[model samples]
Target: MEGTMSESSAPRFRVLMFPWLAHGHISPYLELSKRLSENNFHICFCSTEINLNFIKKSKTFDEISSIELVQLDLPDLPELPPQHHTTRNLPLHLKSTLERAFYMGKANFQNILSTLKPDLLIYDAPQSWISELAALNHIPSVLFIIVAAVNLSFFYHAVNCGIDGTNEAYPFPAIYYRDYETKKMIAMSQESKESLPEDAAFSPKCFELSSFVLVKSWREIEGKYIDHFSFSCGKKVLALNLLNVQDDDTKEEENNSHIMKFLNGKDESSVIYLSFGSEYYLSKEEREEIAHGLELSNANFIWVLRFPVGDSIALEEALPEGFLERVKERGIVVDGWAPQAKILEHPSTGGFLSHCGWGSVTESMYFGVPLLALPMFYDQFLQARLAEDIGVGIEILRGENGQTNREEVAKAIKMVALENEVGELLREKARELSNQMRGGGEGVLHEAIKKLKDLCSKNK
Candidate 1:
């Protein structure tokens, strides 16, 4: 960071940031890069080739003039094609190959670090090995955690607690679901311990090593969790305030897509916006149930439904029979990406049928869109729990075997979107918090930057 006080003669600080190669991680890092660049820091934003291509295509990437895009030349692996550089496009089995390719870039990253000698090195989940490189050269490394603060706090607590796998009452938010049980964590840990590289094993140590922590969430929605995260880590933890969810003037092309046009024609606060995050794809069964639910609710909707990365089947084949024909007048089932921020900000988007990814949750809350959470994987269940606890959304329940039906989904959407009393209450809470969040973000960023600058200057 540059000096706290802006003067023409202030030293230009250089910052290097590398996030995990998933869209969910890269999106926030890019947003942070743009925000930090506003304060006159030059940022080197690093990602693998595939991710860089994706970033290059984003509207925001071109606007970030102060940020230099650095592409990592990952080493080729036996079973992986050149295009399979990121986990997003890779099949489940090739995940290890992806890991191998990631570590192969460490030497190249070392060379870059030596040349840039950045004042601050901020990294996310996958770059844990970079901390030692930064430390050896007297650079201040900060962990820009991209998960919910509650999730971070819980992970830290679980890792340090040294409990047996059978410890059933682990008193964490993640324990809301049976899948997030102690046994599951233990199994996951065992798998990682056996298969993960030594560098990968040290990934969690970034929490212990970094100068401080920066998370994607703010105190407005997760203050207690944030406080616990800081205390648990015994370091400063600051929020970037859901950087991608701001109300600033964005590139019109990004938001003016057909989804927004559809939203434009709907009644105010009447249409439910449905989309899972980019990383996860729903099964055919899941999609049909959701499509049926949307149709049954008689709610106007704009749904961004996607197939698994390279599957090229007709969208109608995956959805319920004649579903599109039945709801075509009132709903538009999008087959690809939608401008999520723009959709949420649209006055017509009343409720979000979400996967409860922290990014999606934050974006919905920031735009005052209540969530109808259908969490499918890690930490999402916890996020859904938080949404319910905050009285901003209702979770769509699942059976003991994690199955959800159309009727249950339909009822949850109606509760969040059309039920007058319940919908109004959630809407009010969401709107109030959204306003408070937008106002609080800049101050938090300013203070965090000031403190980080002081620390970096000392390192210099």
Candidate 2:
């Protein structure tokens, strides 16, 4: 149960939250901040100036009170560099930039803490150095993981590196048999000499440095992965359901609008929604291939194609001969950013051709929109497993050695868009899982906040 504070019982605890500038990271932290604020906790929600300005414009932030939203401005560093602002490079740049930004943030945050020393500091995982500050202040520093716990199995494997008789080059599998019991494991492939793909942000180094780690996933939704990977960590491995809102009555109306405008009264399951998160983009060839695939599938789609992968989008030239003209009546090509959550809620949107980012995955499951997982890099391969193995969505097979072809894309699209065998089952599972996400979700957040509070109160 969420605790209520009386004027006399209010603990006057201060909490600081630092999120990476990207929307994906910022949104989840914001949700936690809002909940904490309602419990009378003072919060400093920190992000770069550009993102703060974007939030100022968005309706999401308009009604926010209680929590003090702090904009940590970097006049020298813009959101992205001039030439290489593609989604693949932005995260790398943001991570690098934060090394400097972190210092500035610390100065500002410390100044605030001096007047009122915080009882707790809740930071995103990447903000590792904050743990030292918390230790010095004798406050509790809890690391908040934005991704799923299954993804953190990579970090756990890294921590046991070269332990016992294991080799450093080949880290121990999370799975192992102990003296009296068998250690469970998240089924991740062993790391090899193969380099990480461009989009991967989490690293083993991150896990080694932190004392506490918490990821956003629920045992009810991801019971296998949680039971296997997190059983050893105990309270250190917290499993919380992601918070999202979707209403069936509202969704039914939205679906009707989608079909009336785009699909000519076709069934709700006939249309597909395509998105590559906020960071990814398609090359002209890849875009054309996708366009061709959708056309071949004879499926209506809402494709959110931003600027080309590396440069300005010459959309007309990049498209196949008269492709735009042919699909104008049959498809909705959003050439720039689309309101993704809104689009996903539409009834006509039966499946998602997603990049498999955690935020996208959570959103899909929350809306009961089954996915045709198309992971490009990062933790996406692991994310794809949640859908495929866990039975909430169907995983599309890339070509040999995890490659893709236009034909394969077409087949996958048809399978999901038409509510084919796997699609129907995944859809049913998604609805079942989403129901749990909305219910048990608040209990988890309430428990986390209280746990952090108790840790502070005990030590204070």
Candidate 3:
């Protein structure tokens, strides 16, 4: 649906969307743009050329006529070339450099805003300067958070109280991090602090600058966390229901015959689909343990493996010896990418062995696939805990040092995928939640659209 003129035949409100330079961030922003466009809002979707090129290739991009892809060019740095502008397959060491490059594109972004003169700006956090720029142009800005509200609320709590030596405990008991994870979190925080400018505005300050905030989640699953975050930030938080559920069967059929064929041969509710998202890659030990665990579980499975850019390590080198031969009939290992949504929607896929990225968690829930959660890092641990807390998934606990063993992984797979009382209960709960989510988001989305329009009108 394309946006139409108002009853008075006035021009549709124009929104400029600026997401951070990561696939995860860009994807949610694109989905939100689609929603806004359908509500009679013209959207100027801005990103680096590489990222925009990627969006142009997507099947969904062809269907949206109301959105215009605008390119925001970063300064030409020899180390950070055009291809490296996006975070897809980015080298770990160059991450900070990429951020610096993104920050340097402020002048170019300002030019875009000036040329487009959008009535509103919808942007991601950590780019708090955007709200200020939008205000200078007499436009309202809304910060769109792509992660789970539970994860954001936890950070807000920690930052408000000190990370260490806090007198008050985090409000949610179920979402505490392990010792190793806590240490890693602190280290990451310090690293980010050092990399950016002293006055760089993070989430807390970004929340203050926005007219309102939007999270890519619904109240059905995260009401408490969303309420907590809204109260703490003093911003009206609107929830955008699960935004990435692709319904494009035509594209799936054209690209995924081999994978669909493999899944078609499997029994109903018998195959486990494993993936750790696009950005994260497993260590050698982690790969061996997961491979051995799949062997031990004796469950049919499909696992997607990814390697960092320019890394040429073969599958045999990455996995345990003879692992492929051992599971030839029962398993398929895809390198780089797969049709994740299609696989989850398949009747044969009963469980998802995942790193529990928020996107993956929502997709699994939408398809009523029980989660075999093995959260690896950052907000993933919190998302994994939320999945378990809701009784739609079970976590594969690691040691105090955050080491995963084959036994735990196998146990989690069997408990979630095999025919048993626990698995049955989880499946039922997943279906219930899916039903609630599918049935209830239209009202919330309409309410959010009204709020956005009100903001635009006030500024006009």
Candidate 4:
């Protein structure tokens, strides 16, 4: 079956996009789908129903009729139900179970392939079997890595050189993880290994099987790392140059007036926007330290707090006692969700107190908001370092034992947001990057689309 033909009688490449069951992964895939749909590609975006529902509700897709949503159903296990199919509010322990369930849905996904018979497949890196599945149907597959190129390069280096090898240090020294973080990463890696099947394909295998790789970054910020990653992987690594910025959702804007109102009242470059992304939950100690730090920073701020799926902890109870009353005048503590892009783009948003998630980092950079980085896990540490290395942010280094220090948090916030030399320099650099990133990416994106077309044409 030849895919859908455009009005001009040209065959529009039908591409199946399967991202891992995480908001971070799914969101970029959707954005990529939108981009491709505009350039004569029909996209079948496949994910669990729960995730697809969120995408369906997004206003970004309202006009993009070429992008179709396809649901990949996972078997409902006792602990893993339809509601828990996504990683949004999922507990850390159930993460492995979700992966297992995702893998178990292979047959269902295979059926989807049989029905769609797409020209190409673009899949997330975690589910390495996706490439194999696509190959089985003679479909070309590309690995879409949502993480930063620096992180991928670091991991590739570590894996190739052995993490414990003293003979070879990572090529980039600025992006090294702390001792405690290293320990945590090792433990998590071991846990993942024990939980998943022994034959499960990882990054190396995924790179091997893919026709090419798509990284969610641009050349300006990570040219060296992108080049390094390509050399390491021995595959054509194409930068999607997808910043994942969208027009503010009209529905969300109407509901989030209070947040904008709060920002309007603040002075320009005086408020810090605080959010730790959706997946990572803070411990009580971490929460209290941050609350106290916010109090100490004395900067006007909008802090968004989120809890796990089943947790019913109240806002007052979760924060430090008297913290709300103390900072009420200068700060607004939002529960659950907020319009992040809107807040970042606002004039009052001076610094982003972020977990250094790639999505958050890119958004922050796009808006020229300097970062007060507080990275928690995974590639976040590297992303935080990248922001600092690029002169766009400052990392709040933890204690030697890896404990969050309130004073350090406050110091970094003041340093990044306040009108000091350091803050001024960071903000200027951020604006410079924002200008570059905004004006750039068109050439890269066009080249990437051309490559996709070439790949699909060859398969045909």
Candidate 5:
């Protein structure tokens, strides 16, 4: 359903996209931009230098020459190192410092916007001020949510119901529901305590301010929640899938020969790929528990462990004692990064043990790998629910006080990765749903582009 207009018929318009510093947000925005560029649209992708470092080196970076990756200079804070330009490794409190740095770039950003004068602006949830800037310049804005619709619906419902903290009628279960958004609510309360007008809605006014809201999901995956969000937001809500799936046919896999050989040696559907998301390094106790779970499951695995940048990656100390020697024959523990998409498509990869970040979920499901989800925080818990509801995944249970025990982690792996009736059923359902992602309707993404064009046409 992808169509390329001839030279004479191509539309001429400029779009400026500003995603949050997180990898979860920046990745989807780039995917959408790549889609837009095929229609002859000019794109301005803005992020800090630290955010762009990894992106600039990616293979996809070469695929899209049309996108101008602009690196905005965040204000220099004494507490932060020049290399530490993002919030990836910083403490939770220092996250506020990253926000302050973003606010400091407003003047520079406005100047860039004035010069570019893009027809439309696309932004993320936390930085809704970009929408206000678009309004000031008389350009339409789109709130492109990187998270799932269920999360957004919960946020809108919470604000409307005046349940900022906890109330009896809260939507999710009592334990997770109470802990799900407590930190976010506390942050919102703290922001309120600071100097601000009584009329300020919240930190992220994405729902309240934008003309259009776009989510990286579809009606098939989350129909009822999508409808609920549309009704609550009172704006045009579009749930179109925009994942730029990397294919194995590409020669990129050849670059990582050691990994390819490891996966190639394993039997078909024998190995589980395990990774926590980019953010949130695993605690020592948590890491040891996961290591034990892998040992207990007796399944072949390639566990990708992410440590802090510039830290020495000593596998012996980080993992349990004798863990490397114990599982060396059947398991391989990779440090830092790996080619995720390539490994997921390998025939050996049967399931994914993940942090349930939406981006990772989209990739895992699209490639037909059943999920063993261990959701940590933010929108991840809600994302894990999507997998459970679809019956293609099983959640790793935590304790009453939110402790992830070794036994529960082992059980989840046994259910999904090991050969059993339950594992086969989950894997079969996963393959079926994977096709649903692509073939329900061919023109879904094409239609989304048309709508964006129509919005831009109005401005001209």
Candidate 6:
């Protein structure tokens, strides 16, 4: 259902949705924008020129006619190369350069808002400077997290520590890092076997400081997460879950199309889906190791290799003798990219060998597919933790030096794809969670839109 303020209410409020360029961030922001538009709020969705180009290519802008798409032209920073469009391709130097650009972008954004005068601004958590910009202009702003509440809680409560303005103030353990058992916790986390609570509640102060702090989770799948947050807020803060739940037939049709093309019937239920997300590119050696492992296992697989192998590192040369010829009929290696969600939802897809990106995990869970998480870095590590904790996945063993070998790779693939007992349990858990997540999403959305309408009415 479309969200709306009361009919009697006049349309006065304008909203600006400024999301980071990644699809993981952009999709959720778009979903929220759609709900806001139904309330008759004037909306402008902003993106950098590069991201806008991507949206154009995907026809995402065309899907939402009511919300105007605005592409911001970034000035030529002397530090950045002109061709650096996709953030995924950039190295650490370019990332630092981009952070500086974002600060400047905030100033440019303020200038644009001077004329447009949006009543509020909503941005991803990384854009903390945007909050300062909004405060300067007397506009209310909120931080929208694309991650689950449990992860956010860990960041705020566990990982971070600060000393007070007075040097005399002692460093007390934060809410997230409670109970003072630090060394043991650290060791356990390293083992990759420990499990934290499946969920966590939002903090009271987080709600008190913001007009709304939007999180991308629903009550059904995360009842404990929701219950913890709800009680802490005392019903004062609004919790919204924006998810586009796909119906059975629609999911099946999309999945089937991808599956048929990829599989072409080499071996039934033998194909594994391998995608490590856009940002995490495997080195040439690692890629070779993976290729060798897949061939050794003799399993049919589709691997999404985003980066091309260097001229000196040809995949064919790297493979074991007669490996390519043997598995040529068994495996399909897709270069650059693939429609991840569609492939994950396919009936022929037995398991996912993923980078453990939250969007990837969510898609896998929604379709009830089991996982073999190969987290390389960043939030992926945390996602791996959640996946294992939730009993929906098993972590692929990376060596002490944070590397994967041919033997480990072969074993992990076999475990998730061929092992009946483990895969069955995982599929069952995933299905249960999937239903809860999609089921609670609607109720949460309805309540959020209502609260938004009420707030809009009060402003009038």
Instruction: Judging by lDDT against the true structure, name the best candidate.
Output: 4
As a whole number from 0 to 100, the lDDT of residue 375 in candidate 1 is 86
Task: Report clashes for each candidate as comma-separated counts.
Answer: 0, 2, 0, 0, 0, 1
Would you list the rank order by TM-score, best first?
4, 3, 1, 5, 6, 2
lDDT of 1 by residue, 1-460 (tens): 3436555566667889888877888888888888777766788988888888888877677778697888778888778776888867466567656776777788988888888788988988653677877888888888988878877776666667644324444455433545534445456557666776776754467676798888888787888888888987898888777556523235644554666678888888888988887667777788878888887899888888766567746877878778889998889887756667878888898999998988889888888889998987667877888898888888887766677689989998888777878988989999988898778478888887777667667876
Single out the weakest 10-residue window by summed lDDT for candidate 3.
1-10
Best by TM-score: 4
Kindly list the per-residue Cα lDDT of model 3 for residues 360-397, writing each as its tens digit.
Answer: 99999988889999988778989999999998999997
Global lDDT of each candidate: 0.78, 0.63, 0.84, 0.86, 0.77, 0.63
**Which should have the higher lDDT, number 2 or number 4?**
4
Q: Would you list the rank order by lDDT, best first?
A: 4, 3, 1, 5, 2, 6
What is the TM-score (0 to 1) of candidate 3?
A: 0.94
- Candidate 1: 10-residue stretch with minimal lDDT: 162-171
Model 5 spans with C-alpha error above 4 angstroms: 1-11, 87-93, 162-204, 245-256, 440-442
Q: In candidate 3, which residue pairs clash?
A: none
In terms of lDDT, which candidate is stronger, 3 or 4? 4
Model 5 pairs in collision: none
TM-score of 5: 0.89
Instruction: Write down the TM-score for model 6.
Output: 0.79
List TM-scores for all candidates, in order: 0.90, 0.78, 0.94, 0.96, 0.89, 0.79
Q: Comparing 2 and 4 by TM-score, which wins?
A: 4
lDDT of 2 by residue, 323-347 (tens): 8888876687766556567667767
Residues 1-460, candidate 6: write the lDDT tens digits.
2235454366546777887756677777877887777656677888877766655544345556477777655567876644453465555335545555555565577776676667777777364456666666776666666766555544443323331213222222211221222333455344332221111112233334356667776544444544444444444334465654322244335544654676656444467889887666777678878887897677778887775223233446545567667777777666555666666666778788898777777778777778888876555665676677777788877665666788888997887777767777887888788776666456656766666655545544
TM-score preference between candidates 1 and 3, better one:
3
